[model samples]
Target: MLIGEVARRSGVSARMLRHYDSLGLVRPTGRTVGGYREYSAEDMRRILCVEGLRSLGLSLRQIGRALEDPACTPSALVGDLIRWAEDRLEREQELLERLRTVDASAPSGWQGVLRIVELMHGLNSPSAARRQQAVLAPAEDVRVPTELLAGAVLAESDPNVAGALRWALARAGSDAVASVVSGAYSENVDIRRRAVLAIAEMSGDEATAVLADALRDSDPTVRRHAALASGTRGVTAAVPTLVGMVVEGTNDVEAAEVLGRLSLDPECADRIMAALVDELAAHSADSAVRIRLTQALVEMSGTIAQGVLGQLAHDGDRAVALIASASLRPVRVVGLPDDESCDDAGRRHPSQVLRR
Candidate 1:
């Protein structure tokens, strides 16, 4: 077969075929009567071999060595090729993700594109401070991509940087809610905690729904954050968790205050009081737990807590009795009758009774 005929039949361009011949990767092994290049059957097979290797991302030099070196083993060379291709695939995937983020941002020009790219690089910087600055210093006219910010917030560990990232994510608005929620389901506990914290800062039905789901997370840390935020948002679903927090003494003070406010709702007040009273009864043997619960009662507004406190004033544990007795003093004079009245100011303990 002539060189032109081989190129035409094999779909290899003539220019590329000539270059392959020059590289010694394939030689015609014959000359026509007219001095034209004539490819023998074996030459065509060699050309096909080189093309096959090229399709696997092998460099021409590597391909040449692969074909020429009798000592070269296919297992070892193929292994190397696989590794190289995998590395390239990973890098390409990262580049493609960056490109998708940039396109999602909808930059107006190359300058906008460059700015966003720089911000993304900074967000991925090794130093926490640099990542924080990237979030803080975005161009006034350009919007930082929410997906990028959401991912950063989930992985950020530094207290200050995490706060800034959460703030930035909140500014990124509800579009970031789903990304942050996905982080809540991460296997890493720190990421799950960060996700809940970030979701706490976001507003909207979606964010609220995510928080509600987080309230039942297996990680106690995640559940506590969700409860605190959900309590503030008036999510009565957090009542049981908040009550448990009061019993456990972890963020118990804040939990009590939120529960107190939540208790103002007529429908929730009885249930809230019942939960507190039940915890108090359940943990009665632990004096410290009882003391904490007794103190938490000061934040409740309904008559149920007042009645509970009145009964606790004479609790079997002296410390519990003392704390409950002292907690009641500010409510009224020492002789004020129980189940009677100490006036409206004394009816329910002051809202600022406990600070956590």
Candidate 2:
């Protein structure tokens, strides 16, 4: 077949076919009297093979090596091709996400688009400081999209940068809640942890609801963060996890403070007190555990906690007795007369009692 006929039948442009011939990938063996290029049957098969390999993302050079080199193995070359394809796919995916974030920002013009792009580049920068500034210092007229902030919050590993991202997301409001919530359920534990922390800083029914759902996360870290945030939001379901934190000594101080605040509710007070008392009984064998529980009681309000403190004041463990006795003493307000105790300060709130 002449080059024209081959190009027509095979759909390979004549110019490309001539280029392929020059590269020796598919040189026709025949020629007409006019000296035009002609292709044999074998040459057509080679052309088809080259196109087939090209479809798999092979470079022209790699295709030549693949077809001409007897020692060339398909396994290694195919593996490299797979890896290159995956890399390309990942880059494309990142580009798509960046474009989506930009579109979501609803930029007013090219300047707005440029600003968003600049912010994205900063957020993805290797320097934590730049990422933080990207979140903290958005352009004057452009508000960083909530989705962009949420994405940064999920992927940020540096504590400072993550905190900044979370702060930005909080300022951006509940619009980012869905995006952050998806990270809360991520299969990656680190992502889930970051998600919960970021969502914890956010306020709104959506954020609170996501936090409540996160309370059941299999990862203890995720559950603890969700519990701390949820408890403060008046989600009584977090009481058990808050108590567990006290038992495990994980952020136990903050947990106890939250528990104290929760106990201010007349209905919840009894339950919170009961859970604490139960933990005290369960951990009686460990004086250290008992002492931590003893201190946690100070956060509780009303006479019930005082009674528990009274009993612990006389307990066998001297350390526990000391902590309990000290807690039982009336906490004098800094500015009030020595005679005026916290009780005389107009029934201080449980959280206030903890501060004292």
Residue-wise C-alpha lDDT for candidate 2, range 196-234, written one tens digit per residue: 998888888988999999999999999999999999999
Q: What is the C-alpha RMSD of each candidate to the true structure, in Å?
A: 5.2, 3.9
Question: Which pairs of residues collide in model 2?
Answer: none
**TM-score: model 1 vs. ground truth:** 0.83
Residue 175 deviation, candidate 2, in Å? 1.3
lDDT, each prediction = 0.86, 0.88
Off by over 4 Å in 2: 74-78, 331-356
* Leading candidate by TM-score: 2
Q: What is the lDDT of residue 43 in candidate 2?
A: 89
